[model samples]
Target: MDLKTASSLHRLRLVSAPEAVSFLLLLVCSVLKRTTEFNAVPVMGAIHGVLFVVYVLFWLDAWNRTRWSIGTAALYFLLSVLPLGGFYAERKLKAEAENAVIASRARAESAVKA
Candidate 1:
């Protein structure tokens, strides 16, 4: 992948897990609000909301840069909604970025030899 695409993917990957965590925390806080006096729903909700927006923006950028197919884009979008799915998305994105780096290096090495 090109540098822009790689960077976008990196950004998305970086946000994915944290976004997932925030979502989980928000859910927990919602439960706590109902069951106990400990209420952090507003705070957690805002945090998760910001992260979700950031994730979506980054996702869009990565999708645009990489020219992913409809299925691939849909999969990523779906992952954002499902609980704990961000972790899986992060893992997948990391692997993809690593593979891109490896391929980029191989191409560079071959060009140097030529």
Candidate 2:
């Protein structure tokens, strides 16, 4: 992919895992607050909220730069809400980046030959 697309995806990938983790942590904190003497929901909630927003922003940038189909965009959005989905998205993005690199190389080689 082009540098802008790659950078956007990379930022999204970076935020996604943390956002997922924070979401899980927030769940745990909620349970703790409800069932025990411990309460961390406020702090965890804020962290998760920021990360989630960052994920959305980066996701939008990636979508715009990559020009993904509606289905693809929806899939990414779905992944954001699932706790384990970010990891899968990261793997898929890596593959996409590799494909883009290969395609770029092929184009460069063709241009040289022509």
Candidate 3:
């Protein structure tokens, strides 16, 4: 694949877990703030907000560079909102990267043979 696609995919993979963790932490903080004296929601909210924005920008870049179908792009976009979605997206991206690597290697082997 093109370098832009690879770069965007790599970035998306990197941010996925961090964003998910931040989301879960923010959720926990929200609950705690409501149920008890604990109140870390503001801090967690800011962290999650930044991560979410980064995730969205990476997602858009990947979509544009990778030329994903609308449906595929929507799925990735939807996954960002769901609490556990980042993990899933990360897994999918990793698998795609692996497959891309394998394909590239196979192409290289064939070129060498030729």
Candidate 4:
């Protein structure tokens, strides 16, 4: 794949797990707030918010470059909200990037032959 696609994918991959972790932390913070005196909400909330925005921006960039279908876009978007969704999205995105690389290589080989 081209550099732009590769970069966008890399960014998304890097952000995915952290985003998920932050989301899970946020959930835990919410529970802790209700059950105990713990108040990790502010810190975790800010972190999750930043990570979520980064995830969305990278996802949008990849979607625009990849020209993903509505279903695919929606799947990724929905997946971002779940506790483990980011991990799933990262896996799926990795597969997609691999496929893209293979396709790009095949096309290049065929063009060289022609």
The candidate that wins on lDDT is: 1
Return whichever of 2 and 3 wins on lDDT.
3
lDDT (tens digit, per residue) of candidate 4 on 25-57? 999999999999999999999999999999999
Name the runs in model 3 displaced over 4 angstroms.
Answer: none
Error of 4 at 5 (Å): 1.7
Residue 98 shift from truth in candidate 1, angstroms = 0.6
Which one wins on TM-score? 3
**For each candidate, what is the lDDT?**
0.95, 0.89, 0.94, 0.91
Per-residue accuracy of model 1 over 1-114 as CA lDDT, tens digit each: 787889999999999999999999998999999999999998999999999999999999999998989999999999999999999999999998999899999999999999
For model 1, the local distance difference test gives 0.95
What lDDT score is found at residue 17 in candidate 4? 88
Candidate 3 per-residue lDDT over residues 31-72, each given as its tens digit? 999999999999999999999999999999999998899999
Candidate 2 lDDT tens digits, 22-99: 989999999999999999999999999998889899999999999999999999989989988888888888788888
Clashing residue pairs in all predictions, respectively, total 0, 0, 0, 0
Better of 3 and 4 by TM-score: 3
User: What would the TM-scores of all predictions be?
Assistant: 0.94, 0.94, 0.94, 0.93
